[model samples]
Target: MSGARHREEDLLRGISASAGMAIGPLRRYELPLPRVAETAADPAAERQALAAALETVAATLESARHSADAQGQQEEAEIFDAHLAWLEDPALREAAEHHIAAGSSAGQGWYAALQAEIERLRQSESALLAARVDDLRDLQRRVMAPLAADAGAAEAADDDLDGAILIAREMTPSQFVAVAGRIQGLCLAAGGATSHLAILARARGVPCVMGLGEALLSLTAERAVLDATHGVLESAPDAERLAALVAERERRQAQARSAAEQACAAVITRDGRQVQVAANVGSAAEAQAAARAGADGVGLLRSEFLFLGRAAAPTREVQRREYAAALAALDGKPVIVRLLDIGADKQLDYLSLPAAPNPALGERGIRLWQTFPELFETQLDALLLAGNEAPVADAATPLQLMLPMVSDVGELRWVRQRLAARAAELGITRLPALGVMIEVPSAALCAVSLAREADFFSIGTNDLTQYVLAMDREVAGLAAHCDVLHPGVLRLIQATLEGARGRCPVGVCGAAAGDPLAAALLVAMGVDELSLEPAGIAALKAWLRELDAAALAARVPELLALDDGAAVRAVLAAWLDASAPRGFGVMSERRGHTHNKQ
Candidate 1:
């Protein structure tokens, strides 16, 4: 482990949470834990004390959630939602009750319960589950401090962290939120790449590296070079390396400024073919960010954000408000909102779905909607109501509705009939365009038939690649195999376009769309639109402006003939190295390294 820590010699190794470089003074910021007694004198009083502490924590989390929502910080609000859910979990309560009944104090019982839960999660095979251990520890501290009457752990410090690289054993989401903007970068001794801290760091464009273990905690150097792009921390850099890093930092800043300046410009290939660059957002905040980043439109509005991680489904009025807020953020830009695509990996405790051997291949998305038509109708009504509220300045770009997991034309027709019925019921005359998401092999194979009924087609490459390769996306150790750049997935994409036959615009909204290398190949294949996350829009557009799509088109036949993903990636890398413009060095080096919170 020590050898791995210094893999490159004199540099501490870790996983990159965000891509960037930062050279600054190192500052250690630790959140102390409250000590607790092992046993209690009164069991009844201990139980009551535990109950009160739970209520306090829940109320605090709820307040934080509302504050985040009011501030248009959707991801920050969702982090609180997970904490609140844990507070309401029956298993967690039972675990604490058992400990209290065994003659333990409220703080001790809660601490033990959370520690056990954290250990269990750490033993899980899923990285997502393991990454949640910090959250559980956070809850333990929150509840324990209240029971122990210790206010020190929860108080905010006034320490100045400006332009300093923060070092910690682990960080909670709330802690990260408080110091996100003040810090230059982050280095965690124990944390996962998928942790909420990492997500916040990436979103804020803060250079971050995690999972360095005790080696990071042993660092006593006052200054360090944090190269998050390569996931290495250098405590002492020579004069020449320091100078090079400074120049590199200036170059990156200049590149970012240039990209932002050209974000709103049309992405026309050198050969004069226009390609739409849109954003895939989940909330009004994300949509607004996309618009500000110069996205042409919202290509995929993940409506599930409004429904998931809740005690109950959102009301029609609530749904209407959320949708309208997102639409208003886009102003006149086109927005495609996907219907409720839940069940499977995303489950609601209130809705007890039937158990399946493999949830990924089970009844999900449109299939689940079919089982609960009332839920479907409620969302449809809300969307139509929002659409009827106010007219956009650009009438041509209306709110469009998309259906997910449609395997054939029948599903498209079924959704269209339902959409029309709901619109008519609400006295709405102008129906939004209806589209189908090409995710399943059957749907891609039958794109021609479905295209006749649907208004547009969006390829969800994330799902399509997993299905095509017969790999479960959520399973550990399959990320390399589940890559969308595989020749098999590319072939399916080509087939989908061929089936569409220019009857409707074909857009790629999956994770691959955000990748520059994949984006170039997508353009080469004649894809009409590329929709990715908001932060990536500027860089992607800047890169796309340098390519000649017609010239790329001539190489498609050869690219499709490649045997595997590695081969395709090698070809794209060589092409980028030879053809990318001089000013796009950052963009070229960043290709094929897209990191998204899946």
Candidate 2:
């Protein structure tokens, strides 16, 4: 007899995360646990079972680590490493043994012990350790929940659910590692898009739907199609729907690959103006990938990754090694490293500060630097050392020094004086050009004064918009005013650029720079350079290559002349609508042809 044919169908969905389609097999995983009887008599055997269970968990973590490493998922591998450590901990094993001796079955004993530890940790005063302990306990429950179910079943169930929808109340990092490649799309009963699970999904290029409620329970194995982009769960999809979905997925994948290729190409404007494209990276692996992706340099190197979650402050030597590795990977490209910008949002017990009612407006960025001079000095010393030992390049790589959250001229002078003293102490001769981030409204207003003391200006539009409009981007109710295109925010940017007065170069390294229309508007306002996320490089470049900045510049004064925000936005929108279609479309459509012949 011939094997049954599998029919494909088309599925239409929403774009929940704002990216394009990604079609892969559905990979699913359920948290499993070992079976347990109500009564227990064999204490020695129970101990042995616990040890064996630990061994199994360790093996599972190792396998996951290896698989993630092979796939170039370093962050996933790190998650597994944490699981491995938890499984091997003597304290955790001892707790399980004690529970077994108290007359519980093996699986029950393990679950009980884990729950007790979790409760204790959650109640602890140390928020950092409490968070970690909660995470570990959550993983234990997820990893063992399914195994426990199978123990009660008549036969062993399959661990691998190839390309299946993962329907779960929640997912822990370790559970995510255990079923890494087996899941196609994830549907959680509850979670925010920025939650750890969603973050992991985005990083791994997996489709996910969070806060799906109890609708996930109705989904059977390999019988339902989940359109994550649109939040639709189609039970028993027809052939036509499946076929359409598959085709759409393929098209999306092709578009992403094409975009990536284009991002690696040079960024040139319609008038032949060239702007360097770079990536914002946080780790060694990311730095290397950014380099491979044809990023001109590292625009923002967030150093918090090294400091956060550490039991003690990372030694100067360790900090140096991390920075040095990133510099080496850039191969002499300028890497703008920002000092630690922690606050109530990211509180460290070691660097204790009173709990604030509003952290965003409280001690953060340069404020923290002023409060904790020693910590700031250590980081400054390490960064300067990294710059001194950085490899020589064919061209002079402008290793610009950037200070975050400087609101006035005094902050600039304070940072420079400290840098001078530190340099003299270290016996350094030359220093990299110093720059200040224009993120505060006051800084924007006082740009000309601040610019006199700095070598360059990089506008952080994210915070600038938030501060200017007095609107929180996270709050959906205020999203209308939170836009970067708001007249007030645009005026601030214009003023800052005008204040520079061609003395020092000005660039924008923010989400606004990545948007095609926003980039055009900024260029019109005379921004010298634009830095965006690596993924947005191609689309932004395509728009830039079609825009005549001189023409845009001519129109910008008129656009800004209007005092009404709505009027200004309308004029700019109308101008773009009339000019962009033919200009941008034709240029992007012909880019491949021109580049191939060259």
Candidate 3:
């Protein structure tokens, strides 16, 4: 021990989840559910107690919302509106009462009601609603925390999570919400950039860096400097380094503001190639933010948000109205609505799916359509009516319907046939242009035949990589192998592009499309469009504007011949280091980076 050298600031590099900087002590956050009994002596008293707890939660949300507004955190504040409304919802109130009336403790009844509501919402086709499960779960945990005998200790634990840089292996969206605005920064050992955790973090302006390995757990230093812009973590940074990073943080914020101001302008390459830059949004709030970010159109409109915090599937009218609102917000721009792609990562609890040993390969994507055709059918019906509504879609491009998890021509054909039937049933002559998500490896491999049935193709690189590699990225142990840059994954992309080249417009809407290096490769592979979160549009546009697609296109053959993702990444990195514009600060890392931008 005497001869051992003491390291000065251990450096940990990770993927940038959000852009910002923080200097604080590292704190770890962990929460476990409390055990509550089912029986109670006074049902009415239990119900009353539950109501009071809900009131407390409401006050908390309202205060946070107002704080967000006053601090100029409009989007972050808007996130609480739904939570506030959920508090007043009669249905939610009744569910908890029903459980209490059934002779359960107030805590147990509330927990049961919360679980029921989550299940009901989980079945929703709206992407926004589906994403709310975490928040709802978080709310449930909060209300039940103090119900235990150690309520005081639990509250103290919650308070301790504030005012520190959180270092975690993973955090759910709701957990992130609990510490959202209060935390200085966050570093996770695992999580896709496009995961809900990342999105929620960005909403609150909390800097996050994810995908660091387990080595992050070994750091003992309390004080550290976090630079999310570069995904760097420095333990016990010296004065000079800290000063430079702090200054860089200020410069980046200014750049972000300037970029947002001009986000609406068309993205044109230096050599004159105009590429369509659009936003992949789930909620209406995000849609508006996308417009402010200067998105050409909504490349992905997730349908699951409508299902959160309630038990019933959203009525057709509700779905139509929500879709209409999103379109109206986009002004006359085109919007591609992806049908509920729930299953696997996002499960529909109400479906009562049996415990599967391998859910990832089980009923997910198009496979869900087989077991629950009625759900997709109802959604399809809504899409037809909504698309045909005059106020919903003006002279702009007609709203497009996209089926997730289409693995073959047959699946694509099934939806195509169903669409035709739905249009006829609704007495509609014009049908929305149909598209399929090429997320499944089989779908990419069979893209040629699918092109004949579908009008367009949108590659979901995240799932495609997972399915092709047979590795679930959600599992922390397997995250390293779930990369989209692998040679096999890119080959599938290449095949899909080759098959759909002349037949339909092929685009990528996954997190990978947001990466500057991967975006270049995607362009090289003949992708006609790239969609990502609106926050990344300005940076990606700045980076893409410098190089010619033709120049990158010439390297496609060589890229495809690479032995592995590492080689592919290294080659792309070298190319960028040699060719990327020096003007945009678009320097590539030594080996470049991959993984979808969350």
State which candidate has the highest lDDT. Answer: 1
lDDT of each structure? 0.81, 0.65, 0.73
Residue 508 shift from truth in candidate 1, angstroms = 1.6
lDDT of 2 by residue, 1-598 (tens): 0012323322222212212233333334454444556457888887776667677767777888899789877666656665665666667777877888988766667787788877786565433334455356555664454336464354343455556666676677655645646666676664444344554675665666655565555445445556554444555555665676566556545554655667667767666677766666666667777787767787777677677544467777888788888888888887877678677345553578756766668878888876788888998888777777887664343456788888998988988999888978999756767888898899999999988888888888877887898865443234334567767888899889989976787888776665555677787677877775455456565567667777778887687677654566567656765776453431121121000000
When 2 and 3 are scored with TM-score, the better candidate is 3
What TM-scores do the predictions have? 0.87, 0.74, 0.79
Give per-residue lDDT, candidate 1, residue 132: 84
| Comparing 1 and 2 on TM-score, the stronger one | 1
* Candidate 3 Cα misplacement greater than 4 A, ranges: 1-9, 12-51, 54-141, 144-164, 167-183, 188-197, 210-223, 227-232, 238-258, 390-397, 583-598
318 in model 3: Cα distance from truth in Å?
A: 0.5
When sorted by lDDT, best at the front, the candidate numbers are: 1, 3, 2
The numbered model that scores best in TM-score is 1
Judged by whole-model lDDT over C-alpha atoms, candidate 1 comes out at 0.81
**lDDT accuracy of residue 528 in candidate 3:** 79
